[model samples]
Target: MSIIAVVGDCTTTTALALAAGWPSGHDAVILEADRTGGSLAAWLGTPASPSLSTIVANSPALGNSPSTAWSAVDAMVRHAPSGTRFIAAPVRSRAASRALSEAGGTLFPLLAQLYEPTIIADIGSYAVADAPSVLFSLASSIVVCHRQDAASAGAATVRLERLAELVQFLATFGVPLTVALIGDRPFGPDEVGQFLTADGQAEIVMHSLPVDDLTAAVFAGRTGVSERRLARLPLIREASALARQVAPAETDRAPDSSRIDQLGSSR
Candidate 1:
């Protein structure tokens, strides 16, 4: 399995879109590991039980093996009406923080060992001080999402530098970093790339998703919108393309030994 962590200033919709638009025949599970709390339970109408909090509570019982830990995680997985699997996080920020703090040390390493399903972790904002750095060390790829507006771009410039520093420190050089631009406002892909490159993020790859408020609203839990209709929207279409571009190849699934060793030694 591959772990793709989606981090951003505000990327809930981007994460949801990627999971919803994942390529056919490859199972993708969205893990709500956001330390700031989560919205998937409410948006997808799933129960709060069998959540990140639940997983954290049960982690001590998980055997040392990755497969065993994965089995326990699988037991807590919930599905949306659209059939996408996800593990929810607590709605309360304090509870979410505590769960992540308690479970992160053991949870991320176990997740790194799994080799079956693709786990797309919605890691909330990388800008937060309490952001889970361990997940970044283990992810196969990291997608950073931001709006195309000036304010969002400005924030992303700063956060991307911080992310670059973290990745360098973790020695996760083999992991791919992608910048997904949400909406085409005053800035397009070229402009976004230029500014980011000027800010020393030239290594990051860029992708864009169109503004589709109607479809995005449905993802945010608006009732009466059909999934079939959403599939044809620009947002979903771009998300599918983005997924195809970022999904790790089968040959690349195994973690790089040197990188892992470096990460372990540094920790």
Candidate 2:
């Protein structure tokens, strides 16, 4: 029903894992649209075949029927150990990236028409005319994740300014741009929102996820602990809150947050 695109300096994988954990009955898939290369498959230990490259190559044929396109997408999809269905980014296929840039106008519209409920795309960072930029325009909401330190905030400020320019009427185009602050920073969510509004001239919504290195390690697949290990962490809590806001209909019937501990312990 909606597509939430997560980008900027934060850990995209962590966001995807949290979103996947949401109790949305409707299927949720993470589509990695990194412009340079795909690292999601390597991080999750999934093969990179049947990835964005394959999807782009098959775009012509996929346009014929919605069923056919969905089928094609399904073929490239992989289920992460955490139970999230994903299509990894293409590996070193500059050609594929170029193709995505050229035909994204046609490709993403079909993807939106075919997929329902939610599609969370991991767009590493904003690059002008990149593959993710095309999808950015079509997304229902954009979540820009950045750390709180001075350097990061400064970069984020510049990026947000550029993003506002890229998507005119971003505040009123039915596409809400949200900033998700990750890690410790001098400014709180409110202050950061105010700053973005003042400096970038973009009315922004903001949310923050506390810095938890261990929990982040688990989400990135660098740590061997089960994802349930993060059940009590604030990172997960904030993620659940954001997920609920973006896709409440999906989690409306879901159990309370405490169920996370139960689910974790059960396995």
**131-223: candidate 1 lDDT, tens digit per residue:** 446677778888877764556756656644675454343334457778787766656778766656664534678898887887677777676
Q: Which residues of candidate 2, in runs, are more than 4 Å off?
A: 93-96, 115-117, 127-132, 150-174, 199-201, 248-267
lDDT of 1 at 101: 74
Score each candidate by Cα lDDT: 0.71, 0.64
State in Å the error of residue 214, model 2.
1.8
lDDT of 2 at 70: 71
**lDDT at position 54, candidate 2:** 74
Instruction: Kindly report which residue stretches of model 1 are placed more than 4 angstroms away from their true locations once superposed.
Output: 128-132, 150-174, 199-202, 251-267
Model 2, 71-178: lDDT tens digits are: 766776787655557777776758547755754666667667654646787777664454336676678877777665656767756754665454334454457777
The 10-residue segment with the lowest total lDDT in model 2: 258-267
- Which whole-number lDDT from 0 to 100 does residue 249 have in model 1? 71
